[model samples]
Target: MLDAAVFQGLSWNLLDDFRQLFTYPFMVNALEAGTIVAVMAGVTGWFMVLRRQAFAGHTLSVIAFPGAAAAGWAGVPLALGYFGFCGAGALVLAAIAGTRRSLGAESAAIGSLQALALALGFVFVSLSHSILTGLDSLLFGTFLGITRSQVLVLLVVAVATVAVTAFAARPLFFASVDSDVARASGVPVRLLGLGFLLVLGLSVAETSQITGALLVFALLVTPAATAHRLTPRPWLGLTLAVALALAVTWAGLALAYFSIYPVGFYVTSLSFGVYVLVRIVTR
Candidate 1:
């Protein structure tokens, strides 16, 4: 027979579990940080996906690894390296591509940069040697160690990013959908493209701290992709993307809290699953 006692001892309760979610200080901080990152990722990722710059975003994400590693090696705040390197990477990519006509060259440049970033990450690891102890967290993520200050920083960045994105949304949309037409109609396509890339870099850097270098796309790309698949309207898609991101982050945190698995796995799995389901239904 089945183990009736085991089932009885489980005693699952939704309300109880929900209450326990924020009982701990660490959990509180993590929840706060995660919410900010989720919102920022959703807003920024919408433009990123629409602009077809996922490859560039991925490169910025990978760059976060070496950035943090280099900081560890130099005994500095990891955030500085994250922002600095990612911003630099964005500038480099923007410079290399310049305009839409250079997309083929942009792809080549992005690929080369991605390769270099991966290699530099390993170089930093080797240089740090025994000091870079958070490699697993750097690659995969662990929200347990997030502090109140980190949460605050994330909140500030999220607000600024959302505001800027909102301000630029109309022109950005025009340029993204039809750059040639937008430029012909006085849209400042090149400036918008460069500005958007910088924002994408910042978003990737911020999100990488939460989702880690390897799984940034889980929060940044998948929800946006799923929302786009399900909705045709830009405003609705953006809202849905943010909501889906929050849902994924909350669910992933809850599941991870009650299980032995890492949060990244849950987050990535949920994101991928939703994307697949949306793709199927949309098709």
Candidate 2:
């Protein structure tokens, strides 16, 4: 998969691209919004990769879709509805399993919720007056339509997510790497797990707005997975993950603007490609 010719042609210079980026208001908005989402996803996704909670992240995204659709049908803000629903689902999972269940059981619950959410989203779409295009957009995403207000909202979420993650980093890491040891050492493993789930829920809900629920996994998994493969150092892994996420989001946005496909498609494809490359190299 390593293409020497393509690698050779890729330019790192930003000056030429800088003007192109600022020439359009949509591009600016996309960049700002994408960067904010990337930072949050990157930080939380690092723990997600380490803890093997990728399935939970995916389930949260799937559940958010129906919530967004229902919100749209009711003429409310989609983000709030999406977060509320996914957060509730996260809470339910935490309560039922006590955040200490085996991976097999967790996976089973996530799978069930994923299916249920998609079914509900489809049913809502069928009953609503809105066309399939709107629902489809929420599923696959369309960054070109993002407004400046949305960008501002993204910034706020990003800041809050990053701040919380920073403060919770030590205990979160301890619990994720070894919950038994953490709990033995007097760490509130259950509480930590629930808090992380809440953060994951919010991140997935916000990202679903930009990349859609189906494609949110790309942002939530790829960069962190790649970073984990490249290094075992926690801080280094997080740094690499954030950098990779930012690069993919910015590059993907540029490619989408220049291509015919939607931004989510390009972003997901790019992220998957990077993960594949990292896997190959690490192997």
Candidate 3:
């Protein structure tokens, strides 16, 4: 919901430039939503990387494209399309896992789904006239038109995601680390995997609303990947991922507010920069 036309310049005074970030109610809502998104994406993304499901996460993001396009074509709420398609995509991926997780199966399933989704997205885009005006936001995301209600919706979803993640943390980690051992220990690995994909789907959908479909994956994966490179310990990685995500989201929002750039580029660049820095330091 960023206004592509607005160009708010930053003043030389550091304090004034920072203060102007909160001048509009929309900025406040964007910050709140970004904060919520950073937390949920960071936590879930940590597990997602550990479980080697980045491909699945990418596929889900691809699905969001058509989901939004179809919503536009139908004159319906984009949120509904996003959540509905993403949740269903998660289900399909989970179903392919069957009674156990198979890396091969997941890859093939994600590949097919991604291909189909891209095709459908193009078809929908061609059919939907209304979507073109907001195509940039749909693809890259914006922080311009966030309302109080949307922020409230993000809050509710974020709370649920955090609560479920907390409740399932132990078993989920065990399963993600070693599904065979966790299953032998009666951890219900398949169920946990299903639940995780669902949570991930929701996270993708929620983030896509603010960060755009394509860029949300970076928010979900980059910070976690950076944290993983920084620490081998699970808790530290989790904490670091959340911290990094929050930092990049806030920085990206502020920079985009003051310059002529898409918020997605700023976020992606910041996250990648941190990731590269970690890679260098660790080497």
Candidate with top TM-score is 3
Clashes of 2: 0
Model 1 TM-score on a 0 to 1 scale: 0.93
Whole-model Cα lDDT per candidate?
Answer: 0.84, 0.82, 0.88
Where does model 3 exceed 4 Å of error?
1-6, 99-102
Q: Where's the lowest-lDDT run of ten residues in candidate 1? A: 1-10
The alpha-carbon root-mean-square deviation between model 3 and the true structure, to one decimal in Å, is 1.9
Q: Quick one: best lDDT, which candidate?
A: 3
The TM-score values for the models, in the order shown, are 0.93, 0.90, 0.95
The alpha-carbon deviation from the true structure for residue 277 of candidate 1, after best TM-score superposition, in angstroms, is 0.9
Tens-digit per-residue lDDT, 85-151, candidate 2: 8889778767756855787886787788789999999887877887434877889887765688888
Candidate 3 worst ten-residue window by lDDT: 1-10
Q: Clash number for every model?
A: 0, 0, 1
The segments of candidate 1 whose C-alpha lies over 4 angstroms from its true place after superposition are 1-11, 99-102, 131-133
